[model samples]
Target: MGTGWLPWSAASLASGAVLLVLAALTLPPTSEVGQVVGTVRREDAAWLMASAAFFLASVALTMGLPAILTLIPAKQQVVGLVGVWIWSIGTIGTSALAAFLILFRATVRVIDISPTDVEQLGQDPVMTLSLLFVFGAFYLGELVVALVLLLASRLPRWIPALLLVHIAAAPVNHLLPEQLQGVQAVVLGGGLMALAVRSTEAWAALRAPATR
Candidate 1:
């Protein structure tokens, strides 16, 4: 297919990154299972729901990122293909996680959970698996994408560097003080926006000679 969607996809990806940042800002912190349950109970439902909704929207909007990056001219085509496949896994995992969060929020209001429920929540296979995705697939995919960009793509050096920084900061974001939890999201969003601008310029450059 032609790259007519390149600019549009890039724009959507940037918008999704911004929304992901908002989701991170609004999501309640969790130190313990009990605390998480408490947050679900005590935090404003709207806020909790918004976090999930934004996350879902973000993932949905940016699902084409792997494709976009793969289309960029690269020194190593095989490496770019590998990166795309790896990031695709991460996309799937993140999408599942987002869906889980949305379902959790949707059901929480109707279901009554006692202390017993909280204890079981940790052991529940669905929840455990979802949490596992955070540690492994979700971040790993982005890490590989950054590496692919750094090693393969002809884009400016800063693009991959910023992505690396964002990936490094994301997992640790919750450990930061409440005031600074959104920093990773901002970095990621900025990087994605930069990528979008670069893509737009590259598209124009490619079409410039054709227009002559």
Candidate 2:
């Protein structure tokens, strides 16, 4: 099979990493949620725009994963495709929910909605459903991808190992200090970049003419 897809896949994966890093850096800290809301209410669009951009970047990152999986061997392609479909659904759901939240917040700010109303919106059924789909589907999707990669043996052992480790560390990541939480994004980005580099090298080798 031609290796031409590898470079494009690597580039998409690398770009996803970059976008994830940007999302992390731009995202407002949960600890400062009140302050962020206040700032957004005061006609400061920075945080709101940043949040929107970050969520959108996450969508892009999610999309890139499936694209890269296309490089998997034919026999294992079914597994990769299944994982990709699951993840893509979660990605789309999460991104849409996030985008909706951002818009709702902006609307509240502009309309000067009451605290009670805002609180109700926080507990809105749609919001709950969105959160459920986002976290539940997203995590499950990630697990599927990780498991498929581990089983397929398409890439180096270390690549899938790193992915599994990253997934396993999710609980511990939440325990990290607010300021330190973003570090996970950096770590993830580094892992993806490493995968990209490895893919590039392997693709080149595959394309090289056979030695006598």
Candidate 3:
């Protein structure tokens, strides 16, 4: 059981790391806001498409975490499962948003739309609402998962602590230097990888015959 989940968790973490790197690299520069159309064009549609793909992959991988948790001898499995479900919802919402944004960008590039049109699109109520939902779901899910992990004791002490710090720092993350923003994703991916390895080991030990 643990062996089966390890691959999924590792893949999820890897995909998340790639998505973070792509976001940091491909995001439009702050100075380019006035030139929205140019900024949109400046972004590589391939990168956006890749990000969407990774986002979906990460979401799929997350589903396996709860199953892995169920194997652990812990009383708080329900809490952890709830967190996983919440995170899944957020990841799915964000994945859809990522896909939609990619398609929208491709359409804009194909039509060679002007900055004014881009601005108008941004102002559209539906777009604004979608953006809100995406961000809201993503963050809320992250927070819940972090809290559950912290309490569940299934993961290492440091893993949940790091995740909590990452979540708590969200509001001020932008205040830090631009280069530091991507560090969170790296830390998260590493933590997930570690969790996967640990889970695999635990499962192996449980399955092993007693030496005596």
Query: Of the candidates shown, which would achieve the greatest TM-score relative to the real structure?
Result: 1
What overall lDDT goes with each candidate model?
0.67, 0.67, 0.62
Task: State the RMSD for candidate 2.
Answer: 3.5
After superposing candidate 1, which stretches have Cα over 4 Å from the reference?
48-62, 70-72
Model 2: colliding residue pairs: none
- Taking the tens digit of each residue's C-alpha lDDT, what string does model 2 give over 76-175? 7887788777766766665675577588666866786665665666678987786877767766776777677777777777766666676677788767
Clash totals for all models, in order?
Answer: 0, 0, 0
Query: How many residue pairs clash in model 1?
Result: 0
Instruction: Give lDDT: candidate 1, residue 69.
Output: 63
Candidate 3 structure quality by residue, lDDT tens digits, 51-162: 5655665565455454346434457666666666676666667567667767767787689677677678878999889878766766676666667666667677887676
| Candidate 3 ranges with C-alpha deviation above 4 Å | 1-32, 49-53, 67-73, 210-212
- My TM-score estimates for the predictions, one after another, are 0.81, 0.76, 0.75
For TM-score, candidate 2 versus 3, the one ahead is: 2
Cα lDDT of candidate 2 equals: 0.67
Model 1 scores a TM of 0.81
